[model samples]
Structures are given as structure tokens and as C-alpha cells.
Target: MGSNIVFSANNNEEVMVLPVVPEIEVNKPQNNEQFETLNNGTINLIGDEGLRTFSIASIFPSQKYSWLKHGSVAEPFKYVDFFNKWRAKKVPLRVVTSRPDGREWFNMPCVIDSFTFKQLRNGDIEYTLDMAEYRFIGGV
Candidate 1:
């Protein structure tokens, strides 16, 4: 019911809202196994669902434009630092995404797999973040 994509590292209370709604890429692949049979045939078995990956590529504009959505957008480095700190802590973040009409779309615990950014010539920070779903195995 908030921004399109929001990151909450502390407990879903303090959230770092995005400045611009970037492209949220989701990848969920199925885990299947194949074995060779005795008659030169193959047997395929379907496994459980694989963890979904969430990717967001956007730019932090130095100055807020008229079309920007997010309300509270801080400095470019602030966002970079936010993810860096959470990543170093090795904690699972609650990633939430909603539709335009305020409907819950995808919500889950995800870990930051990789984050890359570059400073553009116009003082904007272009970044790409990759995160994977985190499942509690063997009872956390």
C-alpha cells in the first residue's frame, strides 16, 4: 500500500522508499531432474519451486522531477549506503511491491545478492540491485 518497491531491513517498520519506480524483474524457475533409464530413455521429475529473484534498475535523479513518484528521496549515496549496510549485516529484507491501485503484489523475505551503481554525467546515480528469495530451512 506504499511505493511500488520498498526495502525494509529492520523489521518492516523503517523503510527506505525508492525515488523512482524502476523496472522490477522477477524470475522464478522450476527445479526439475532428469535421469537416464535402462532403455536409453530419460525420466523427468518435477521438484519444488525455485527462489524468485527480484531485480530493479533505476536512476536516482539529483533533482526531483515533476513526474517522479516517490515523496521522500534523499541523496544518491544514502541509498547506496542503506543497501551496503544491510548487506553487510547479512539480514533478510522484507521486499514489498504493489500495483498502481494499492494492491499487494509480491511480498517476501529477500537477501541482497548483488548491487551495482555508476555515477552518471548529470549527477544521477544509476543502480541495479539483485535479490533472491530467502527461505528458512530446518526451522531457522
Candidate 2:
């Protein structure tokens, strides 16, 4: 008996490769029409009806008192003095401004010092308003 060996040299095998995934395409608004269409659906009413809802306004007096805070280091005192003036006039005081991205100096502990939780509640506000114009008053 002789040993038998088998060998194949013409064998062909195909290697498969996966296709690449396409990048995401974001369709940004090109004009006001496209912009308004996306935003209009979210709005319900306009004019007086919208105005009837809770309204918040920011007032910059012509002259800030000497006791008021001027720079960022003393901004908290400005908020405090504003509320104090409102209290003196017997008017409710509420604060509404753009939502802060992170821990702002105005939102720090030292800035809100002495104001109790309940008193702080009176300074609550709904949403920040988008003002078309703003004015800062200098010396009294």
C-alpha cells in the first residue's frame, strides 16, 4: 500500500468588505421663511392675548444709588437694592433674565446673602425676555 496525498492549487476565495456609513446631513434654515415655519408651529396666540399673560420688565434707572453695586464684583448688591426699592414702594419685586449657563457670580451664595427662602420666592420670574434695546444709567 502506498500513501496518498491530495493538494489543490486552483482554489479561489472572495474577501468581502463592508461599505462606509454616510455622514449625517443637517438642513439648516436658509431664509426667514424656513426659520419662521419651524418656529411658528410652537406659537399659539399673538398680540393682546400674549400680552395678557405674565409680563416681566427690566428697569435701568437714570442714577444708581451710591449704596448700589457697580461692577461684577458687587453686582449682587444691585439685585438686593432693586428689591429693597421695590419693597419701599410697596410693589412686588421679581427678577427675570437669561438663563445662566453655569454658576454665575450673581447666582453665588455671597450674592444672595441675607435673603431668606420665602423672600427669595417673591423674586421669582417665568422666562427671560429678549430685549431689542437696553440702556445703562451712569451717575445720579
Candidate 3:
């Protein structure tokens, strides 16, 4: 079974591994339904399924440090630029998640719906990413 979870983003040629592991929350697609009463007391249903959403919360240190996975140092200030670029580009990213039971979930062609940053009293920074699966009209 896999133990640790890793997150990586492809800004260009380099795939930066997020230093900290965040809690991933996945909400499955919900069914949308509406019922119309008939004269016989039976109901007719009409509706479709909704889209899924994902949210991740983690802390990004405001200091330069090396990540053991990539063995590369990352500066906190650079993350601001990264997030800004990703938000502005409106491109789909591949997000891979590994579970503890040797199971991996891959979410591709996803875009960042929202990105938020907060500063704590301890001088630490926290980032929350809200994403949604992108369904292409043609194909991804």
C-alpha cells in the first residue's frame, strides 16, 4: 500500500512537487431530480447529474527549503507567482492522488476554480485549492 501522498504541478518543463501533503476532499456528482404529480398519483421524474468538485488544504512555509522528493529548494514567494500563472492561464492540469491501500486516483483536465491564501499568527502560510473536473466539448 502506498504511504505518502505527493502533489506535483507542471508549470513548464519542471514539475514542482508540493512540499506538504494536504487533506483532499472529493465530492461525487449528485443526481438532480424533479418529480411531477400525475392524475393517477404517480410521479414522473426529470433531471440529470451534476458535476464533481474537489478541495485541498495545506500549508506552504514562507521560507526557502528543499523538498526531499525532488531534492530541489523552493521559495515561498515563488508560489504566489505559480498560483497566479495557473489561475490566469485557465489551463487544465493533471492531479494525481495515491491512497493508503495502493490505490491511485487521477484527475486530469482539471482547472483551478479558486485559490486562497491565508497567513497565520505563527508566521506560516496556508493555501486552499478548490478545483472542478473539466469536461471538454470535444475531447481532452
TM-score of each: 0.87, 0.19, 0.71
Which runs of model 3 end up more than 4 angstroms from their true locations?
Answer: 1-14, 39-49, 63-73, 119-123
Candidate 2 lDDT, tens digit per residue, 1-140? 11111111112111111011112122222222222356565443332211111212222223433532222122333433544443455432222222124221111000111232122233322121121111123841
Model 2 TM-score, 2 decimals: 0.19
Across 28-134, the per-residue lDDT of candidate 1 in tens digits comes to 99999999999979998999899999789998777777756665474788888888888898878888888888897898999988999999998889998989999
Q: After the best TM-score superposition of candidate 3, give how far the Cα of residue 140 lies from its true spot, in angstroms.
A: 2.8
Clash pairs, model 2 backbone? none
Residue pairs in clash, model 3: none
| CA RMSD of all predictions | 2.2, 30.8, 3.7
Q: C-alpha displacement of 56 in model 3, angstroms? A: 1.2
Prediction 1 global C-alpha lDDT? 0.83
* Candidate 3 lDDT by residue in tens digits, 35-123: 65666565545456556789878766655545322432345545556666766776666566666575776645567888898777765
